[model samples]
Target: MPIPDDLHIQEAATLERKAFAAMESGHLAFRQGKISAMELFLLADKWELAEEALRCLEKTAQSS
Candidate 1:
């Protein structure tokens, strides 16, 4: 069965949010002195998120 486009979009959005949350948690852990915590964060980033984060950061820097 073919999934509807709307559902696909919704699912992608949900996954992206989860990935972002994981990355954020990893960063927090890293800041708090947990080096190994970054692995989980990167795993999420690998799911088409790290590029987005990097782009956003770059844009912010450029605008500043």
Candidate 2:
């Protein structure tokens, strides 16, 4: 398997951070009645995906 470059790892980290921020925003929106429960769930999924991607990249980087 090919190892991820520094740029790829950096991008993955940034994506995870943005996903977390978006999830937090979604929670605030839900609390304020600005978004539906389904929307919040979708944001949670997005965060999970980002988190997984970052973990995979980090693991690959470490192994290589």
Candidate 3:
């Protein structure tokens, strides 16, 4: 069955959100020193997550 265009948009948004959530988790883990740099690289690779957390930080710095 073909998905509707509206549904596709929603799905894409959901996927982007999921990616961002995963990146947020990775950021926290990295900050807490619970995960090493190598582990972070592996986690990001395994999940195919974007650098959403890093982007957020960059935006904050630019605005400030």
Candidate 1 wrongly placed segments (more than 4 Å) = 37-64
Rank order (by TM-score, best first): 2, 3, 1
lDDT of 2 by residue, 25-49 (tens): 9999999999999999998988898
Candidate 3 residues lying further than 4 Å off, grouped into runs, are 46-64
User: lDDT (CA) for every model shown?
Assistant: 0.61, 0.85, 0.66
A best-first ranking of the candidates according to their lDDT comes to 2, 3, 1
Which of the two candidates, 2 or 3, achieves a greater TM-score against the reference?
Answer: 2
Model 1 lDDT per residue over 1-64, tens place: 6555555455556656776777777777777877665575566548566457555545544454
Against the correct fold, how does model 1 do in TM-score?
0.56
Question: What TM-score goes with each of the models?
Answer: 0.56, 0.78, 0.63
Best by TM-score: 2
Backbone clash pairs in model 3 (N, Cα, C under 3 Å; residues 3+ apart or in different chains), count? 0
RMSD of 1: 9.5
Error of 3 at 39 (Å): 1.7
lDDT score, candidate 3, position 47: 55
RMSD of 2: 2.4
